[model samples]
Target chain A: MSQKSEGGLQEQVAQLYGTYVDMVYRIAVLYLKEPAAAEDAVQEVFVKLMHWLARGRLQEKEHIKRWLIVTTKTTCMDELRRQKRQSTDPIEAGDFCSLPAVWQSGQGPDGERLREVHDALMRLSEDCRLVMYLFYFEGYSSAEIAGMLHMNHSTVRGKLRTGRRRMRILLEEDRE
Target chain B: MRQEDIREYFRSQGPSETQKDRILAGVLEQYEQETQGEFHMCTKTKRSVSKIVAIAAVMVLTTVSAFAAVPEFRDWIGGQFGLTAEQEADLAASGTLQNIQASASNGNLTMTVHQALVDEQGMYIIYDVDSDDGSAVDVSLDDLQFQASESAGVFLYSIEQKVLETREDGVTCMALLTGLEDLSGQEVSLSSCGLTCRWTVGETAEIQKIEADLTGKDLWTGRPYHVTGCGLSPICVKLDLDGAERLQDSGFPDQVAVEVANTDGSVKTIQSVGSCGKETEDYRYQMFLFDEIIDVDRVQAVYVDGVKLN
Candidate 1:
């Protein structure tokens, strides 16, 4: 890239880091299931983006945003797989919910409710969690998420519906 | 638990303050590293490379404006800088908020050190520089630098400063500190090595900054005066204390009358005293108003915190 062209890329990279940092952290926390691990993944994700930007690989704002989300998910998945390989004991799927909650500090009922929602969200498959988070919290369309996740649009919609049902059941069970 | 409500709830959910600072600090650190080569605004001078090297020393959490011991000042400063409430709370809780405040006034210009918060890696300062004349004066981020006389150990990692706002009273400024050690507890001074501020009132519009000599001439508070001691060993001068403080700025305490009486009936008044806090208040080692090392004999009268000693 020309020296003049690199200016926009640098600006966008700064924007991505500032604007969507929390989004990246939430996604990483949902998959990695630990605070330290999640923070590390968030940093690694940005660092990777920087490396890409340095190499002149990133060109557009929208593309960089999608790349951040996708790469955060991938980074967490790799770490989880690495953790599983290291465990001498067999790790089960349900073990994720049972994993110690990286409970972020909040106050009162709203805080409690959000914690409950996050706990339930983490119990869903990483794919479901990512898709549902994008659809609801980030306000991404199924088609947009489909492209980012490289899944069929219908498949993304199906997961979103199922993820909603699962989260309701988990919260309701806690209440009972 | 409606799905929509829960979605909204999760949307509101974000990382904790600790996690956010950790993430942002890491990311910005990387950005600052690469961006320095690309941050092209302050790099026009021959000294630009060194200035860039200075800012490359350490990173200060971003700050925008306000100076010193005023409550209204802090509030305005908080709003101006991109500091979150959480970060302010953190700095307060860490005791960095109650930092050293120093001020200096030359005959023509007055500079006040409003707030300086130092951490392990750096310190941040908010200050105001006002000309008594109050015409056109400017201190760019390019001009402000930090140097601690005592702290020779710490090296400048990086310095990011901005002239936040300008008013007739003075120009509001903020500086980001990056260093190897904590500077909050230390006494440091601000310098404008390539200070370019000027008063357009003069016949030629005298550059106030050019008048600011970096060779220990202009201090943020008062010009530092050097006085030599007269002691008994060589019989040059005994009990003649050096490094006395002059009544210059608001930061200075009240002056004590110190005089070195010589056999020749010549007595010199010392402006400031050197004491170790509340205890061991020794005023014999006073800053005598002497540009040259004066040779005196015999002991002189000492005033320890205004209490005269016979």
Candidate 2:
């Protein structure tokens, strides 16, 4: 890029940095759970965006948004993988149970019941958990999730079915 | 059990409006910042009609009239700045031009200018900042004025006409300033959108505050803008009490010592818990505290007493 173009890109980046720093941090916090790691993830994503812009990519606003989320998810997964490799200690079970239960209409089960459901969901594999999150929490359809995660539609459907079944069983156990 | 049940549960957990506003502001700002360069570039190319026609006329006239005929042109114009072919094409397409303002400071003084035009195809003004040393420079917009109709957010400004037109862009009303080239480079660059310009003068000053605070009912969005605080460190539980005493007193095994480790390898201990009861046999307990606030959906692991329960 020409020096002038480079300067322009820098100005835009400064603007973006001013605007989105917090949102990126929040997303990172949501995924990484470690403040340091979340900050690192957010910074890394922006740096990556800068690099891409320098390379003449990141063509649109939607592209940038998608890049942020996808990169954050990947960063979180990378952190998880690194911890898994270095540590021999068993992983903690569900922390969702630690939260107090409060219920409102249109909200699913009460907190206690939800915790039970979450605990059961935790028992499933990580892939299953992710599929469930994308489908349920994110309000993504199986097809949409398949595209986002780059998985087969059938596989996404199967995972959703299995996840739902497992959750039902767990909820039933809670009732019992 | 049902999808509705799950949806309700999740909806109940949705972030509060304040949090959403903060997040959305950040998201929108990032989006705007990232794309603004291209937008400016496109705008610049579109608005440079007179310059383009002049340049083209000069190029054609020089070829036909002979280079020597325009000898005084070099002295009269000093130099000719022509857009690259790609830039020209981009200009033809977008039909818009944007001017940016900036400020610079020497040790004893500061000067501001609205320097460059940009178009969608990505072009900008270049100057040698280091040509004169001991001078620091910052760029901003000034005297950004706009008017909006009752509806529409489309802002139209004619740099040559000195007219500002504002219209609705869907839901938001946009303010537009035209004929910005008439303003000094410094003022144009430092101009703020949506509100009055607040300039702070000092030796070590940074930004000239341009308050873009939305008015009246628009404040329902919760402050036209807000900054998100830094992420918090995960909460830690310290177990300083003797496990043996509590476990023995509670009829629990002293051999069972509980340890907690975060994903980052930071460790803590869980002391004074009784021995595994009958219920412990059927159900396992894994305690994992997040190192920071997180969306519940994004939480990947929760460890309990140093066990990979998840």
Candidate 3:
């Protein structure tokens, strides 16, 4: 490759990482729950982005973002499956300390509330957690989330409802 | 916790800048390593070609009025599809590259098939779509249709369309179509909108293609399946699975990783060209196209789901 093309590639990759790294990491966290594993998934997803951009298959920015989300989910699912095969025990949310240091230490103003919410989220199933994350945090409609996650629309809605009810119960138990 | 709190909590959990930077650096390093490996493979292929063919390749590159489109097509193949120099030379010397400046106009857009290179495995066509008023124009595989002569029994297994460039007046695109049968010497026709064009498939140079019987083969998904056969081509890998009755699009095992173990003791996982799958009757067929035309001779083995097929 020429210096010019290599420079172009660097620029393209940096642009992609800058634009979507956070989104990819967030989605991976919803699926993987472990920060280190999520970070690894981020690398895999971006490597895919580099290959796609090099091939000129990525059409527009929106499409690229869509592809990244789907790829991240798939990568995390693969990792989860590998984990399942290696060990009979499933990866529970509490198996690892997924709470951030700030939330765990309760240092910020609403740190305790944030930690409670995190615990409640960790209690939900991965799919339910992902649907809730996309709907509430990402501001995606149920239909759009369904399309991105490859789930039926009704399933997405049901997951959202189930997640909300379960989290409410967990949070209420904490108050009591 | 309230929904607002839940959203805010997860929002704050995004990775830190240090973590993002570390992941980005790792990805860039991986890309560079893969790119260097490909560079070495190309260099090795060039060195292995016969000197006579190399000389003839040079001659054709410099002075071939009959092959006016060879240089442009060669550069496009090299730049976009990353064909090795030896592969490009073989295509030219074997008379497989065809220069067809055939054009057809529909409404305000004129579509011209600039050049085409065909082999028994697949066909690569370079074309241009021009708008009458220098407006933006685009063309996709869905907008076009292909038909081969009935005697050839050539069915398109998969097709990919890529826009090479978007000039002010129009866009240049490349369409790669892999087939289930031999395409060489078969007259194939294409139609988009109301315009139609035809071209005879050219003779191809010797290329490595592995045909394997996939009876009772299991995919990485561990599903009991019966694939009719497998074709390992220079540009793509074609797979036909029988008894895929009532399988939805999502049910097709698209993520079965295709890896090429090259003769150089390096394994290259084919990525990014994306795959196309078609369901006909009780069959699910797929073609995994490479971003570049690979030198299949360099591939020592082709593996799907860790099972070595060739």
Q: Which candidate has the highest DockQ of all?
A: 3
Q: Model 1, range B1-310, lDDT digits (tens) per residue?
A: 6666667655555666555655655654554454443232222223322232233222211111110111122433345444444333223322333323455676567776666443334344667777888675677666776665446764544566767778976787776654223332234467652332221010000000001112332222342432222221100112222234532322333233455555466665554312111101343222112111222112334332343333
Give the lDDT ranking, best first: 3, 1, 2
Q: How far in Å is the alpha carbon of B274 misplaced in model 2?
A: 61
Q: What are the per-model numbers of colliding residue pairs?
A: 18, 62, 0
Candidate 2: global Cα-lDDT? 0.37
Displacement of the residue A40 alpha carbon in candidate 2, Å: 5.1
lDDT of 1 at B28: 45
lDDT (C-alpha) at residue A101 in model 1: 41
Error of 3 at B195 (Å): 46
Give the lowest summed-lDDT range of ten residues in model 1 chain B: B200-209
Which candidate would rank higher by TM-score, 1 or 3? 3
Query: Per-residue lDDT for B13-70 in model 3, tens only?
Result: 7877667656665675565565542211011222211232343234333432322110
Global Cα lDDT for candidate 1: 0.50
Q: Indicate the docking level reached by candidate 2.
A: incorrect
Model 3 clash number: 0
**What TM-score should be assigned to candidate 3?**
0.45
What C-alpha lDDT, on a 0 to 100 scale, does residue B260 get in candidate 2?
Answer: 38
